[model samples]
Each structure stands twice: as C-alpha cells, then as structure tokens.
Target: MDTLTCHPCPLDAAELARAGRDDPATGALGEELAARHLVADGCDLVARNWRLYAGELRGELDLIGVDTAEGCVVVCEVKARRDASRFGGALSAVPPRKAAKIRALTAAFLREARLPYPRVRLDVIAVDLGRDPVLHHVLAAL
Candidate 1:
C-alpha cells in the first residue's frame, strides 16, 4: 500500500473546518485521509473518485480498493464534518438511499472494469475536523 495525501489542498485545517460542506479542499483532504487510513489497514488502492456513466445515470465512487487480508474488493464512502456532533456524526449522513446507490455503483464498476473478487464489502470512513481530527471507520457497513 502507498501513502496518499491531499497535495493540492489550498486551505489549512482551520480553513477547511470553516469552509462549507461542498468545499473542494475539505473534501479532498477528507478523502486523502481516508485513503491513507485504508492503506494502513492493508487495502490495495484501485482508484479514488472513480466516476462511471451508464446510460443516463452517473455515479461517483469515493474510494475503491482491495482488502488484501480479506481477499475482497472494498468500496468506501467518506464523509467529513467540522463538528460531527451537530449532525449525528458523519455516518448518519449515509442513509439507506445512499447505500443503495453505492451498491448500484459497485455493480456498474465491476461490470465496466471487468474486475473480479471473491467478495465485495461496503465501508464508510467518517472524518471529523474539529478540535482534533478523528476518523471513524465502519467495515462492511452495508
């Protein structure tokens, strides 16, 4: 596994915390952190921000990697927040609807990329960039 970081993040941690949810810098840093964390946990990265277009629908997968230990493909969704406590934390953001979409995206990815694996798992990484940066990882979340 290789280390990944937000190389082009224009905003510092403090600035990122102050920015809105759609701020690209904050999202990038969050994804980078999640990627590095997954790598440390023994995932071989496949792609980041992988977008797929099938017919009229388009879906973007935040992180797609292989969990070497499990011998399976791992699909990760990353959610970041400055104050997680305010909105029931980041995990709550991924509701059933989002999970369903992720499942659809996984099928599309496997078909389009012709990727094969013994199993496929859905995971979630929640990053809180408040007083201290905290990461919450949920394995096989969906």
Candidate 2:
C-alpha cells in the first residue's frame, strides 16, 4: 500500500459512526474467523462484540474468548484486505485511539457482565478474504 491508501481511518466521529455500522458485518466475519482460528489453537469462545454502558459511555468489544488454560477475554478488531501488504493490510486499521475505545469496552464488559478473568488482552486479526482466506493473528497489538 502507498501513502494515500495506507493512511489510517479518520478517528473523528464520522469514521467511528461508519465503523460502528460496518463493524457488524466486517467485524462479525473477522471475529467469527478469529474464534475459529483461536479454537484451532485451543481457545474457547466466550463472547462477541462485548459491550458495556456506563451512563453515557459506551464500549464495544469485538471478541471475548478464552485461550488455553488461562481465563482470557480476547478483545479483537478485524481488518480484511484483498491483497496482503508487507506490514499487512488492516493491520494499521486499528490505531491507538481506536484501540483505547476497545480497551475501555473490554473493561466495561468485565464490569457489566461480572465475568472473572485472570488476564485480559487484545488481538487484531488481519485477513485477506479474496480467493483464499488468509489470516494473520497479531496478539496484544496494543
């Protein structure tokens, strides 16, 4: 990807709005695929798109799942691409601000759902869902 195409999505209210709408479809596919991949790696699926509401604060978590013997809640954001990049497409999709939102969402999920977790972490699943689906698991991207 070049300079223009490689730029991160705008973090303003508009992009978040667009992302929220598009996420159900795109994030859903990504989380589902990520869950399957995690299962293959011996992880358990706990939740998808975990959300928490505190007053006016709202948080949305992509995937909340378990890994191995650990009680883990996997917060994921999915990015799909037609072709792979050197750093990988969609890898750059979730920036720091976006990541903060996700993390806050995870925190809310734990508090609202009252789920006990030994450790919580975030992951970004980058996929090229063209001819053949290719997945890249980037654990603890933040």
Give TM-scores for every candidate, taking all chains together and pairing residue i with residue i: 0.80, 0.67
Q: Give the number of the best model, judged by lDDT.
A: 1
Candidate 1: where are CA atoms >4 Å away?
1-22
Model 2 agreement with the true structure over 12-126: per-residue lDDT tens digits: 4543343335435545555556666767667777777656666766867666677657666666676765444443566767788988888777777777667566677677776
Candidate lDDT scores, in order, read 0.76, 0.61
Task: Write candidate 1's Cα lDDT for 1-142 as tens digits.
Answer: 2222322224465655554555566677778888988898899999899897757658899999998778789999998776666767666788988889999898888887776676888888877766556777877733
Backbone clash count for every predicted candidate, in the order shown: 0, 0
For model 2, where is the 10-residue window of minimal lDDT?
1-10
Model 1, global lDDT:
0.76
Q: How far off is residue 79 in model 2, in Å? A: 2.0
How many clashes (backbone atoms < 3 Å, residues ≥3 apart in a chain or on different chains) does model 1 have? 0
Q: Where does candidate 2 clash, by residue pair?
A: none
